[model samples]
Target chain A: MSSTPSLWRRPFLPARILRWPSGKATPASAVYEHPLIVRYCHWLNTIALFILAGSGLQIFMAFPSFGPKIPQHDLLHVPPKLALGGWLGGALQWHITFAWIYIATGLIYVIYQFASGNYRQFLFTSSDIKGVWPMARFYFFRGEKPPAAESYNALQKLAYTFVVLLGILSVWTGLVLYKPVQFSGLAWLLGGFHLARVWHFAVLWLFVLFVIGHLIMVILHGWNNFVSMITGWKRNPDYLP
Target chain B: MVEPTNNEKLAHHLARRDLLRLSPLLLAGALFIPSVRSKFITGGLGVGDWLSEAIFRRNHLAPTFSTSELTPFDQFPLNTYDVNDPDVDFDDWALTVSGDVARPGKYSLAQIKALPLQRQNTKHICVEGWDVVGRFGGARVSDFLNLVGANTSAKFLYVECADDYYESLDMPSALQPQSLLCYEMYDQPLTREHGAPLRFSLPTKLGYKSAKYLTTLRVTDVIPQKGYWEDQGYSQDGGI
Candidate 1:
């Protein structure tokens, strides 16, 4: 498939570009799109998220049923195949341990994003909102040409921003569930433990959806995306700033 | 569209077609096998419990709350059986201390309450993810163990409740200062709705570990095989 001449059926769309400091070892010809700190946090997040998902599923499965009880009512339940943490004890252990890692890495990522001023690249401005429809059309409606510009497209910015907010919500809800008494005020603010639990579980499914979309987009974008994440530099000279 | 160079082609580990075909297999593996699934869910899970257990000192007490912080009574009612359950008989109740104790015998409620009494205001953490502060008055589990001359070397304290509920706590938790054989709540005799005659109030454990309507105490060297919910897959270490 790689040898099949054209990876894109149409001319490659231009993307918004951001210039970041390059490592001394990096060649001047290629742009350093992702810094080492970003790469490290991204990979660490991959580990933390996966563990949390499994253990969280395990915890959820202990009760298995959700929502108000009305006999014969259709309530959503996670199938056993999708659940992690074989037992309640095992799941709690996994969940608690990874929760620390997830929180730590998340903090570092936020700090670095702000410190390095890379956060600007993720800003979704009014213009970005206007661009969303066109971008959606370009992807879904085959003949439309994608908007050309810089580092990340408007849709990418919107999605990434939403995900960041979602991550924060997940952690907040998790804490409310984990220590309701200590965080009683916070729990009450979110409408109590049961409501917080529903949000937590729903956010998990949102993450699953996000993962699916992220993988598909990366695949469509080709090896440049993976290579940039892994190596901290874009391989395609044309794709670089 | 730009053509991919030889290096770029080689750099690609999977073609689009291959990824499409392999995705299903990856999903199935994640759903069935822990080892393969854990590749996606990677962490130091094997050492987590060990580390937590090691760091979780026996004397480390759960946070205490004031009487003001005590959870409202009507809001947090009895969880087990309702007030009318026939299984609980408070009128003819006696606590039988047996197994590895030096003196094995039955003691009435009046006799048990006659021992040195203590009161504690501690958080009652529930495993289902809620907590409340309540004042429990009773003999310290350690003191009761001593009264019965329980075998100090025993590994577990297996307790049975009149409600047919059973629980087993580890030796260390059984000896924790906060662990109590509670006979009173809110400075009043326990209501029938609560664990009437007696119950174990272990601040270190989740609500379930504090068995209500407690009827029997068995000091044993063998690790308890199962508790009512532990058999149903609840965490044995019900600690926070």
Candidate 2:
């Protein structure tokens, strides 16, 4: 409601606040929306996530079933092209290796978001609930585009918040599967080893779905939005005054 | 409003400079280069091994299932890299013990079984992701190590199987109370397919680490041959 930006909302780097020859602000100026650390973590985590998913598929090919080993009933076959490592051992190496990268990037991102209080940009809250239906209508039913008052809309905030939580769940479930005995208490909380495997697999599919939706939105939003993530600036964001 | 040309140029320069700041991330692309790919993969795997080993608790036990939860004996899986039944001379079969031990000699199954027997219903988890809970009975490996006067401080316990399958265990894992020189399963003598005579039953490690058809057991610090699957790129410290 205030014209002045909050301390957390201010760009880490100075924004290009341009003025006309008459000293009036112009829309041609650029705002630094993403911090350097945020962009770094984003690209690195993206690469790690893809590698994890591909190698995970290869690992699943080892036992493709949630049933008993003796009477093994394969649930589904993941195509070799969709998989990363050539074999089980090879897949395990990739999975374990990238798991560290994935965890590191995720941890850094979450810590930075909280420490800088930048989480407000995408954290969904009760205030966001009223904006959701309007954004959904505009996106899905060609309704009038809602006025952009902030960096992210309600729907975008909801999706980002959901995916971040999903990322945390993925890591927890993965640990349970990797060392069920060592994390026996956690495994028990998730309904034992067998159920934990199921939950991990389910989390993978949800991640795949989220990635698909995210890609579609990125393509629709075009280069301006995409460039903001890479170069940390948006030339004419709708939210800019 | 039309921006001045100099202002536009400044924005362009700032964006380019910001993009260049992320050039260090381009190093990640080195993973695509064939020459260095294996090194990265192995290095990553090594980190994973180091972390797992660091957190391993020697006394912390793997979970045990109730009798009713045990996987039926008939349904228990027979997993082997080679022949399911590696023909061994049962009459002459004795675990040859060597390396850092006061009594480095052949130990008969009778000698191992003579010690206090332990029965447990523990889970057997495979690297391939399948798992089963089965009842296993054996003498505590620690008891045998004590009887043989083994240097418990040794870093590794290496074993070679009749099937040519070899495995090594970290001394801490080797000394777990649940670690056993297993000779029985499902309250019956181990079948030929299940590494009869002598084998390892370590609930804390993956299935492959519990090598079947035991022929030689050595207490040592150096492992010339890590394990059958390990040499093929599996983690050496395959702790569960």
Candidate 3:
């Protein structure tokens, strides 16, 4: 432990407890679950993703149909309150601007995770598949709480991995929509220009669903788990011994 | 071991340091300020335009469709900011060519028609997100530019329509093989609602960037005013 950098030292070792000073004598059971880079990227990406989604809705209002323009059949009306920018032009400004920020933070986070080998903490794999059912049962069906063996549970890893893949898909679809002629090959792979638009729109809704579930889990996990994302430390985490 | 004074204090300090590291994120919040908001919006659009311009390949052609994929002529939406018909006198109308051109005079429709006709089945994409494939036939803008001896190095090709709609195109886009000074659609002469005598059919650009009812064509470096929608906050490049 003395040979390792404090930030990266035995990150999952719950037994390596920290003892308080004599004045405040207590064993603090805390874990540095999130690195500083992870926390920063998480919050920044949150803001950018929100703006992108809101502005996207406003842009969608310009043409609300997936079919031909002549016999246009609108799918649904996105309420003005739910949209960010005032109009199509305004929305595009927001959408295009934050798209860069979103991409930048996402790239940095992904690169950092891979380079530092921190992805092992959350990246889902075949080994996690069996643990998922138990966690899901505990959360949804009143089954026994699975003992915490790692920083993130199997279900959490699955969700995180799924969202990352979704993020990549959204960016690809968005690029095709932005420049169908320039990225014609990508558009073709996504089933042409019209279908690319459909896919981009679908990705946005899937992101919304993920966010909703994420928020519910955060609340259920209580303040300690939520603070870990902000402060890079989880105090009294259940996973800590 | 040296005894730390207070564990709660140490924890608070650690959290504060971590929180402060994210101060750079505050820059995004500057968008909330009313005075700064517009500037950010313009800056964002400018960056987007810069990126669009960088990636645009002059040689690249917008996808061409088979005639079977063509949208029915009646179903093609006729979108106009002002009036569908500006009621131009076709007999008196001529394309006034000016700026950085050897021939700075009105060229008659017959003179333009003398050039070889090229026809294409291309998609027209609107900024509003609808697209339609249409058959357009015309003389390529490159050929017309050659006829007038235009300075090919000029930065922009600006045009004004009889309907008071104005648009500007980057020179590269103007010289694309698929770009045309169109006079016909669906293999027939254009209707009054469709900019009859002359219009632009640029497959590489957004619909609004291809202004209808062409009247004046200028090859210039400076654009006093950009296109109508662009002036109203739409993207200036307007390339797909």
Candidate 4:
């Protein structure tokens, strides 16, 4: 079932996802991560992103100064560069290699979700959206947390939304670093080879931000959330928070 | 009794409301939460292959090399600059075998290659997190063991490279079908940069243990004589 490349051309998804329209309530269990294939993409993205974070950090440490190098390294005491290029004994290679596979896997994933109905019900919602203001009020203001998100919390919705949109950016920028000459247009769009690197370095930081916050949310919520994904078990109550 | 009944109803309503609010939170957790993002986070993969190595047997499988991310010109560490370098000789290179064998002596590259050639397509695992699907063609070390009638006493197979780097596989892992004394890649002799003369290719183990630049082999019952990574934090069984 996995081998055919043509399946990607016309991804198959259940009709239930297609039938639903946005804003109308779809039970979280009914549409949120129902298919095992979509769930697999979630797991793969989560894992691969963090792996990139760690290994990318190891590589980006090769140049620590963030944001344009306007003022020279002559004045400030800066962190020394770390290169997995050869230093971590090929960690960089593994990062890029898995990234290619990760990209392919995500392509399969998004294609499936887009073909199905959940993309509108779960992912594309902008009701409260995960804005910094809502996030702050949810945490500090003891607010109701934006009427309880459908498939994802507002914060999650925004984070994933941005990530989904930037999917091409991440892979392209990474490629510019991996093989600058091969994908010259990407490098050029990223503002030359050196500028592409600057963005690459910056994205690594963004990933770190997402991860630390992602973890805190997980811990605060507890194992009920964890068990659902691993076991594919969801309890049905009359209402969703 | 009426007052008490009224209080109980109020409490029940609150509890029911909480349950209503509790479920989506539960579902979200499953969709978003993951405990460990990476198994190779700390220092790459430490020998997880030991399990597969013990359970499965194949002396012919070989992982392809096109998958190996090209090492840049600046980063490629080529040990042998010229054939004439005094450190080694292609003609005189010998793979010596000792311990747990009826005949323990060095065999020249020609003699080793002269053994039966075996080939198979197997997965090459990288600790960094990618797998290479390729083919390796060479003679099975098991075939070599059978030829010389290796004594049953030898429980470990120690393969050492000319570079001081060393790795070992348990007798069971060593005897796997994908395990072979590989001499050819992509229909050409394995290059020196890729452990050319004759290297043992076990598709199941992570790339690190598949030592390149082969120089010697020893079959022993001892356990400490394992690959360098095993001596460090890496797990002893380097199976995929």
Candidate 3 Cα misplacement greater than 4 A, ranges: A1-26, B1-25
Q: Which stretches of candidate 4 lie over 4 Å from their true place?
A: A1-52, A59-241, B1-87, B90-93, B119-136, B151-154, B189-196, B228-236
Query: What would the TM-scores of all predictions be?
Result: 0.60, 0.92, 0.91, 0.43
Q: Per-candidate RMSD vs. true structure? A: 11.3, 5.7, 5.2, 13.7
Q: After superposition, how far is residue B91 of candidate 2 from its true place, in Å?
A: 1.6
Please report, as a residue range, the 10-residue window in candidate 3 chain B with the lowest summed lDDT.
B18-27
DockQ of each: 0.09, 0.62, 0.60, 0.02
Candidate 2 lDDT, A1-241, residue by residue in tens: 8887776666533345443243455536567778888888888889889889999999999999999998899999998999998999888888988899889989999998877777888889899999999999998899999999888899999999999999999999999998999899999999988899999999999999999989888887778999999878876777776
True contacts kept of each: 0.06, 0.74, 0.64, 0.00
lDDT of 2 by residue, B41-85 (tens): 878999988988899988899999999999998898988889988
Q: Lowest-lDDT window of 10 residues in candidate 2 chain A? A: A13-22
| Model 2 residue pairs with clashes | none
Chain A TM-scores, all candidates? 0.82, 0.90, 0.90, 0.68
lDDT of 3 by residue, B63-178 (tens): 89998999999999999999999999999999999999998999999999999998999989899999999999999999999999999999999999998999999999899999
Model 3 chain A lDDT-worst window of ten = A10-19
TM-score of chain B of each: 0.78, 0.90, 0.90, 0.66
Better of 2 and 4 by TM-score: 2
The better-scoring model by DockQ among 1 and 4 is 1
Clashes of each: 7, 0, 0, 24
